[model samples]
Target: MHRWMDGVIGALLVLLVLVGALRWVDTTWRPVVVLQSVGPFVVIGLGLLFVGTLLLHRWWMLLPVGVCAAVAWAMALPTFFAHTVPGPANFTVMSANLYYGRANADQVMAAVRAHEVDVLVLTEVTPDVVDRLDTAGLTRLLGHRAGEAHADTFTGTMIYSRLPMTVVSGTANPAIEQTPSLQPEVVLTVDGQQVRLKAAHPMAPIPDQTAQWRAGLTALQRWKGDVPAGDRLVLAGDFNASFGHPGFRQLADGLVDAQRTAGQGWVRTWPVVGRRMPPFVALDHLLSRGLGVVKAGDVAFHGSDHMLVWASYTLR
Candidate 1:
């Protein structure tokens, strides 16, 4: 019986290692992409499996499990170390998905006030939710606004800023043509400096929508590439892809993940309300370039499944 249990544990560990390896593959397959989002958990599972192997006296399996866990840890190590440069916090941005316009507007507004947010990006916004947010004093707090609110679908994204801003045409990449979500870009004048911000809501990588999801991330990558040298850019919203996804990694290549820069390890920000389990994967992000990250964190609201992600940065 002990031998059989050891064999079962070994098989599970092997399967987990294979799943963990998917993070390196740049594929648009729906299942693989979804599985990749749990890469961090896979590392944790490997560690648990190593303990199980040891308890079962499976010495042979220990070496492989330990090595795989080590490799996964190494890959994720950078996010655990602080990379922020010293600078004064001149900007604070927050992002959240409204869960098809069901997120608590008052709670969101309270977060903005508490964080002293300079800019707010919201995804899955609807016309009704926009009205509710306005009633909650969003416009009064952040006078400048851009992006459209859709009534028929949850494709809407909006960016509200305390500073002056103008709606700008987003990337003309054809890949975005198939994306179901609306990605809006805006230019804001922060302390006499032009900063570009985009509210990104990529299609989720589910069956039949994997292609669109990949396209959405690809379009964001194109947008990043199109930015001129020395220009600051911030892409904030429900990206629908976690750091484990290759497409997201590509989009984030030249950008700084605010949470990672602040050395926040394994920060999960999704399914905080509806799921039976606690939040497990971070689907929202505030990725930027040409900025100094001061701090970052997430706050849970009443209705949305996703926690609001906020980051303080210095306009370098």
Candidate 2:
């Protein structure tokens, strides 16, 4: 029994170290799709190490490890609320991904109405749902909306804007069966300035694999060149990769994670309501390179698995 326990402990520690090494390498100069792009591999790895220490009765070692872990987690708390930063342009706009099957569309819609975000981005949106919003008089009620509808599934992607868009990318996902992701893009005037925005909610690795999720990412990535460099960019989505995952690294290469830039700390945005498990890491992110975020916060619950998120940003 002692021998077996030793081997198990050793192996777990080694794996944890390896994951940390990968993340350290990722932070250097590697483009998007590095480990930090998805789930936080460091946190995950350290957690496993702590668990192993506890199980092996390494009380002395566990104490220090526990303290470090607590501090690290404590440092990531700023992202849960919203923040603001001044830039060369307008005051702000916003983005979020509404998982289609979350509790229900009505709850999510109510949040949207209450939040009154300048610009809205939704993923996992179905055409039927969009129709409902349209009928609810979004253009008249909220603002103007542009989105894509798929015959296969009601869910796709969309964007709602208070300002008129000058350029837009998609109200569509990358592509499904020769189709794109159900996301949308809109360009609009905010305070007499034109801002280009992309509201994206890419596929998750769960209920699938890293490879499959990457395929969806590939589609979104391919669209980069089409975006104008002068315009401020906003990319929001529920990318499953934690901070240390390779998949998120790929996408992070081109864009900056709004969470890292503006979020106060390790801001996690998933499973906020009645969560059975602790949110292990940050999943939902609003990112931009040319834009400046003034405020970012997680919307309160709407009976969905994900908490709605919004951020105000200036066009730079």
Candidate 3:
């Protein structure tokens, strides 16, 4: 029985490593192996595997066991620590995937106006929803706004800001043949500085993960780096890539994870259900380049399975 138990635990660990490797390999691979909300399972399973090995007879395997523990611990490093900011001039930035719910958005919009978000970013926005928000007086709540609701739902993304944004450019993706219009980028000016605010929801890693999903990351990075090193930049959305991967590190090359830099806890913002927040795997992020993070947290939740990300920042 003990031998079988050991075998079971060992197999699970091996499975975890393989899953991590696959996540590293590609995004479309997301669906092939993991179906829905796999981040929490991965985090919990790895932790249990490490703990279960302690009672086994083959304790010599402890060396590798320790390595697994350390690796899992490191994967959580980005959001492992919570940060606090000390200041009087505070501005909060929040983002959420609307899921095109007008009624639900009434709650989301009310929350945004009450909080007085400096810049609000949203994706998965439909034409009717946009019109509803317009009629609901979001332009006044935001103090300024830009971008038209898509007529056909090709790209449903928009950024509402209190500082009045100027559309620098929106990338339509010449590389993608299908779903090419979904991801786009925009530039905004706040406090006399141009901040590139990009909202992207790339296709899940299914067919040709690297070429397909990574292409979206590439597009975001292209628009991001378009600005000079001396400007403020904010990249927010569901990056699909979880902990311990190069895909996120690739984006972190010049930007700072806002949750890691200023959050007060492991800011896990996915699978937001029943007012119960889970911190298993960190998705949804508020990242900035050449900007200082002041305040950030899982700011809001409603329709989608993903939570919203909000943070206050200053141009440095």
Candidate 4:
């Protein structure tokens, strides 16, 4: 019994180090990308190491335990130290994925209204729901919007803004038809300056869709790189990739993640479980290149698999 228990503890400690090492080599390979999404679980690895230390009573255990703890802290430091450089918040933006049109529109609207969101982006939008929103007065209420609503697929996406907006790459623009993502680019005159808003929905990085997913990311990268220096840009949506993923990190090269900037990156919004389990991944984001986040967090949306994410940002 003693030998068996010792072996179990030893194996657990080794597994912690192995997982941490795997994360450092984060790749788009199926298993690695999946593991990277749950990178926050490194905390659990630390916990297992702590237990091993208590049970193993071996000097060698301390080495792996310290290594595991270090890795966990390194992964979590950004969430703990996140803060906007220095600025005053001007407006709020929100993003929500409709779970393939299963989300409750009433709940979504309530959250948007409560947050006083100036910009709202929704994915997995269906034409029927678009009609419903219009009938419920959202069309006139929002005033400025863009999207092509489709039915029965997770491809539909829409953007609504209370501010007057000109469709620069979507809505009436024919160029957006070639892109894989349903991202709509719009220019809004905010505080007397032209601010660009983009609603992005990247393809999920699954086995078969990996090529399409990379292409979608490439399109976004090119768009970001092409934006003029004077125009402020904000990108918001369900990226289908976590912050730890290489693709998301690449997307954030020049922009700042609102939640990470506001010290709220630890707040997860996706996979909102129903049976007492809380969310574990942060897949939704509001990223800005010329804005600073004053506040950001997740809001609950009924009947949706993803929680609504909102961010208040200031001109930078």
Clashes of each: 0, 54, 4, 0
- At residue 284, candidate 1 shows an lDDT of 92
Runs in model 1 lying further than 4 Å from the true structure: 1-6, 170-177
Per-model TM-score, in order, reads 0.93, 0.70, 0.81, 0.88
Consecutive 10-residue window with the lowest summed lDDT within model 3: 28-37
lDDT of 4 by residue, 1-316 (tens): 6667657667876776666556556455677777777767767668766766766675565676776777678778778666865556677889998887777778777777777788888888888777766776666667788877768657678888888788876642224322354677788777776779898887787897665665666667777888887678998998877766776778779888888877874768878846467788888888888777877878877777788889887876
Model 4: pairs clashing at backbone N, Cα or C within 3 Å: none
Model 4, TM vs. native: 0.88
Candidate 2's displacement at residue 149, Å, is: 3.9
Candidate number with the higher TM-score (2 or 4) = 4
lDDT of each: 0.86, 0.59, 0.63, 0.75
RMSD of each: 2.1, 5.9, 3.7, 3.0
lDDT of 1 by residue, 1-316 (tens): 8788768977887799899888889988777887888888897888788888888788877888888878888878878888887867888999989988998999999999999999999888899899999999999999988777777557777888998888885432334545666777898888889899988888788788898888888888988998996899999998888988889999999899998888988989988986899898989999999988988888999989999999998986
Residue 150 of model 3, lDDT score: 65
